[model samples]
Target: MADTDDVINTGDLFQDPDGFYEPEKEPTFAEHRMRSGDTVRGDLLWNAGRTSAHYIEERAAELIQGKDVLEIGAAAGVPSVVSAIKGARVTVMTDYPDPDLVDNMRFNAGLSAAMIPANSTLHVDGYKWGNSVEPLLAYLPPNSAGFDVLIMADVVYSHREHPNLIKTMQQTLKKTREAVALVIFTPYEPWLLPKTEKFFPLAEENGFQVTKMFEKLMDAVLFENDQGDEKLRRTVFGYEIRWAEDQLK
Candidate 1:
């Protein structure tokens, strides 16, 4: 419920003069894009941000075109923007639903509207993991099946939210064979990887099939002072999740 001004201050807390972490200069995602007049939100940059954007533009461009896409925990919503620009049938960018977060997403969407295809529609909504899907479902085309693709990047850091995240995916993703949820994450707390990896098994037990897509290591660390394992912090994991064949019944 915090206002946009409060969120701007929240973003400022990430910046430290001692160089412990490199915080993007812009205060918020919307402000950065509007000022730069760029489709990408460089101020809210993450290693996964660039990787996922590239994959969508270079590798998944064809697959994403004309597909219903939903992105969760999309702070900057860069990947979703990329998918929309690449021609998704419809794209919805959602996050914690805070007034500021949701409004910022809308601001970003508004500025990037021209890049989206005329036939493609982009929406912004406030959504919480494991919450009711009814509101989100209402946004889908009246006769549509379900979202064709789900995008989650750098969202697995919170160990407690894994189950809720999976549940949201289950309720929103299409059961079709080709529909998938792209779960990409980096273990900022490298030593906690084993705990983070538990999400895959949890997903399988909940009627989803998980496939490992790739492991990418970043060239730089987001936090220089955190004593977490370097390799784990820098390595990013990409997984493809789909409804288990039997679960469709």
Candidate 2:
């Protein structure tokens, strides 16, 4: 036998490799207080969604009141809740068909039920972009053309889904001049902003006209230590998409 100092040392034989095992992480949430003073919680409460909610509250008479409204990727469903409160005839809030996400949206909707106008309705559902929109359309009044306004907050970040998003818009947006889709997002990963902006030109190519609405700077960045320009990360960009006159004909 060799001396103790010359003995080879072997680590735990049953130990897994460094990256071979990762424990499931607990879900995290972002909490926000709506204008009504009620707090809402979600896996994400993106600033872009808050900006869109403010815009809807500000322009309810023209954009939401008495209109059919749909919010895609409605993580927290704040804008949809506000629309119902503002008197939208029908407000449908949807997100990825994960049980937790859908349940969260429904919970938020239920929390604000008292604030919603008695004559108006707010519904929540799970949806995937580019999928059949028949279920969504069925929520509208019988013989209805389509939704009058579509709220899409913080969704363009998924560059790969741009076409699918536009496809959903084409299927759900009313053909009338008043129909519009609101697209809002922040460059969380500032370096990839160009990719996010590409959604507009793609929308135009899909027979829609794009209009820049506003750029808002929040008090603080969403990801404090995230890379790239903090200003860009803190800024929320807004746009409106509508069927081109030629396309509407």
Candidate 3:
């Protein structure tokens, strides 16, 4: 909704009655799959790669113990839910205009909020990354506890929104600035790497540092194309970024 080509209103899945999303019937890739029989495919319901949240959740559990957490661009919110499951004090899953992820996330809240019992919070809001700070800020009510950590995956799909992505984090993140704030990116292509580097100056301009926070390349395997070709590999890059703690103040 923030006018980005990479943006998809995954909330459309809710326009229909059933929660089931029938992603395009194509083979999934090995890296994106949790089980051998499964693959990352898109449907009217969920978007690409279902298992990345598990990794993000696992990683967050290590770094974010007893800290409030936020995952921007959380398509399905499984990672956020898993963070809650991991006993985080607070965790928020945010995305663009599409509330479909939040809709299902609400169900997750109902199912396990009592068991986890951490200060778990979830929301659906539009974040245009470096576009504007107001949109992302509007989601956090006044006197909110803010976030101690942030998480992301597969968000660097487009080279255009990189600036907004960096700026948005620099603006919206309340905690974990400077050497603490972190953003992770999944690999897209050889071209995407250089485009991401151009934002380093932008990060410095905002009084933050854009380090290669984290990188985890999963197994590569052939998957189907729209035309049913199996020549492509599951191309994804898992990454992270750290910000200075002073930026929030």
Off by over 4 Å in 2: 1-43
Tens-digit per-residue lDDT, 1-249, candidate 3: 133323322333213334322342332222233232322222111222344455544465565556666677765555565566566666666666555645644554454455454355545454545455564455555665456667665565444555556555655566444224444443333333555455455455555655653344446432222322112224344334555445546
Show the colliding residue pairs in model 2.
Answer: none
Error of 2 at 226 (Å): 0.6
> Model 3, residue 225: what's the lDDT?
29
2 versus 3: better lDDT goes to: 2
As a whole number from 0 to 100, the lDDT of residue 83 in candidate 2 is 87
Using Cα atoms with residue i matched to residue i, what is each candidate's TM-score against the true structure?
A: 0.82, 0.86, 0.60
Which one is best on lDDT?
Answer: 2
lDDT scores of the candidates, listed in order: 0.75, 0.83, 0.49
What is the C-alpha lDDT profile of model 1 across 1-249, one tens digit per residue? Answer: 112122112233223356443343342222223222454554455666666766777755556998999999887788888888778988888999799888877876776778777888888999988788888888788988789999998777666677678778877898899899988887776666776787788778777899999999888766676577898778878988998898777
Please, what's the RMSD in Å of model 2?
14.5
Q: In candidate 2, residue 218 scores what lDDT?
A: 93
TM-score of 2: 0.86
